[model samples]
Target: MNDFSKTDRLMERGSAFLGSRYAILCGAMSWVSERHLVSAISNAGGFGVIACGAMTPEQLETEIAATQELTDKPFGVNLITMHPQLFDLIEVCDKAGVSHVVLAGGIPPKGSVEAIKGGQNPAKVICFAPTLALAKKLLRSGADALVIEGMEAGGHIGPVSTSVLAQEMLPELSQDHIIFVAGGIGRGNAMAGYLEMGAAGVQLGTRFACAKESIAHENFKKAFFRANARDAVASVQVDARLPVIPVRALKNKGTEEFTQKQREVAGVLDRNEIAMEEAQLQIEHYWAGALRRAVIDGDVENGSLMAGQSVGMVKEEEPAADIIAKLMTQSEDALTRR
Candidate 1:
């Protein structure tokens, strides 16, 4: 049951909505937020989302069963829309009795929503809405909630920052839908600020990536602890013709190679050496499996170290419960101070 320690009405509602002791959400990280991390967060009284990135149906089922064995609390699963086995993944979640399913990466397929909300299993659908138009469309498409993540976040990001989107979307959308603000959130004060502004809750990935429960390699945690906000830079599109998705990450030799790779691809495109689709694929393939190398294999030098601008705020490795308690206390204090 909710302790109701938070005086803020919005925070209470957020906690109630998620059925968690706290309003905080541990945003799923590709290889990092697996069974161990996900269960720890849930058991600590915060909502945890398992990152189903690139996991097949059978694999996802196994992971879900593993997480269930660890924690009896509510948790969710994050699935990329572009997965080849999208429908199969949904079926796995349904049969696993998953309570929540988050669809990310891109716009979902037509019947995907209906399929998720189908049958005896009751899984709430949460989707990323990049624009107001898309947000309305998703709500109409039966998405139970929306998460607006900005450019400051780690991994693939949009062009806008979190603050601006909160200003632009929260006032109109929050009342009608369960809107969660994400990206660049490192502390409870920032979360409190957003909650006051009408965000139902806040989702954080960068800070949680360093939690003691996290399976991310020690090298990955070290890089996060050592880096500042400025060190985390977003990937840019060197060629306007070749559209490459922007990704925020810590600077390293691999990051520099991305620039060179883009330049080479742009040159090839200009000379008609490759088609537009092929050139885009080349740019995208540069970081394929890079996160796994860093998060799982401890290859910080050459692998992808996806971190938000708030990486500077992450100090040391702490238990998942400690992180949740600190953030909750900070939020309560901020509200009282206001």
Candidate 2:
């Protein structure tokens, strides 16, 4: 085995926390992060997370089972906080003996953390904190670890940049908590920098979106391959009342369509046809469908092509093991150079 002693030592706490050889995490990309890709990442020694996006409890249960069959290495499940069946999904993960549960999309509802902890398998809870205050609050509220993502991330995102968030939150929270830095990270040099700044580890989505095992459609992978950092853009919220969360994706007809979608959903809100919570859920639901169109059907023009700024760095398809090895080797080299 290649000795990455320096880098491994830096990632010791994170690797121990994740029960993996490396502290790297392949961020959950809906439709893309399923049994094949998730298992491949775990098998490659980096942590992988199943994006349980809009899947029914039964679907999630099946997915968990399928992933387990492929690899015995540890993996995580990402559950959207706003899913009406959030608790039920938690039950599914708990029953399947999932090692970790990532509560994303928003703040986890009351008792959600407790429920995950109280389950038969007692999975660790991970939450996303957009700011320093929320990071501390989530840790205090039983979140075993935290992911602080920036606006550069694909799909749903917060307003801050990753560098800014890392600078502000790492010093204050990393000493007392397991904080994983994410968003716009495309290389191991960047990962090394974050580890040096006290991050427990790092998470990356765009870097692995087109891994050889990824199920994203050929056109979708092509879109990522052709995209430059500037080609990936964030959507604009059309109506203030709708409060639709901003989404980052490759610029395409679908990007413009999302603005129209917000207008249509906002109109429904104006007519008292749907409540605010439901309105937000509708927006979330739209993304799931749109993302599927691109990822599964290869409709790059009208389908959402969610991509982080690091899309520019993803030049070709490679096996998950190779991707992880290259990242680890680069990290080791960077650390050695230091």
**How many clashing residue pairs, candidate 1?**
0
Model 2 residue 322 CA deviation (Å) reads 0.8
Rate residue 106 of model 1 by lDDT: 82
TM-score of each: 0.92, 0.99
Distance from true position, residue 256, model 1, in Å? 2.2
Clashing pairs in 2: none
Off by over 4 Å in 2: none
Model 2 deviation from native, Cα RMSD in Å? 0.7
Q: Give Cα distance to truth, residue 133, candidate 2, Å.
A: 0.8
Model 1 — TM-score against the truth?
Answer: 0.92
- Which 10 successive residues of model 1 have the least lDDT summed? 1-10
Error of 1 at 326 (Å): 0.6
- Top lDDT: which candidate number? 2
